[model samples]
Target: MNVAIIDYGSGNLRSAAKAFERAVAEAGLDIAVAVTSDPEAVRRADRVVLPGVGAFGDCIKGLNALSGMREAMEEAVHGAGRPFLGICVGMQLMASKGREHGEHRGLGWIDGEVVPITPADPALKVPHMGWNELDFTPGRHPLLDGLEPGAHAYFVHSYHFVCADPAQSLASVSYGEALTAVIGRGNMVGTQFHPEKSQATGLAVLTNFLRWKP
Candidate 1:
């Protein structure tokens, strides 16, 4: 299947690319990966992976600034309803707004805000770094395929997605509180953590995305 990683000039495209390649090799699946700022590529892909790093506001602005990319992304999210996997700030972009930098609007694909993870226990880090166990709910979509309830995955983010619709949520992770780890509704899937950096569990998420018939 064709997969395109939408690079809006603000992501570590190389590592994301390599991670997908690694997953494809391991899964023994024929998949295409590209760090494309190209609108045409976004339109043509079977699935689009929107990966982002840095501040939430900046990422939204970066996505908005893309003349060709903006329309194409709208098409991917709205027109085609193509399979979407968002990483870190990319996931945050799915929200309605972000409290990070003066309440900037997101893609509005999902209703929510990306807010600072005010740790219930100050001892727990704000970024929620390193490996953490992901607990999944029962009878969800296929994206959680082969992933156990206590599966560990890497995380590196200060803020997490507080979704408006609880039903959209797929999984959660404990960091003082059970934070929303992943959410999938219809064709839109957002992850508060970085799957590319999350090793095998991360690869499984991507693999599910590649094979996802949504």
Candidate 2:
């Protein structure tokens, strides 16, 4: 399988690559992986893995600089209707707007905004880090198949995805309130946590996504 790890100069591209590589190796598939900043590579991939870190506002800016690649990226995942995975702030970019560093627009692939998790109790940390349990409901989706519920995944973010349609949410993880941990609407799968850092469970998730022929 050929998996394309997109590098828009703003994501956790290196770590994402290593994670997928490790998972692919364990899965016994000689997956061809590349960390590409080129948009054309994204359009031509068998599977697309979009991962990001840093601020959402800047993430959009960096991606916009590569308009051709960005256009291709938008089409490949959101437009061309291919199987795509988004992580961290990359997942937030799937939303309509990101309110970090003022209001910024996202891909609008999913209807919602990326907002800071304003905890009722200020004692709650802003950036929810460390391993958290995923409250997933088993589905026919290939991404979740064979993956047990209440599995632990690593998370590191200040803002989280607020999906417009709750039915679209595949799973969620609780920190203060239940944050949208995963969203799988059609061929697109978005996650707020970093599966690359989630160890075995994380590897299994990525492996499932890679082998996901749908």
Highest-scoring model, lDDT: 1
lDDT of 1 by residue, 134-206 (tens): 9886557788888888988888888888999988878999899889999877898988777888888888888
Q: What is the C-alpha lDDT of each candidate?
A: 0.85, 0.85
- Candidate 1 lDDT: 0.85
User: Candidate 1, clashing residue pairs?
Assistant: none
TM-score of each: 0.95, 0.94
Model 1 residue runs over 4 Å out of place are: none
CA shift at 63, candidate 1, in angstroms?
A: 1.0
Candidate 2 residue 76 C-alpha distance from true site, Å: 2.1
Q: How far is candidate 2 from the true structure (C-alpha RMSD, Å)?
A: 1.5
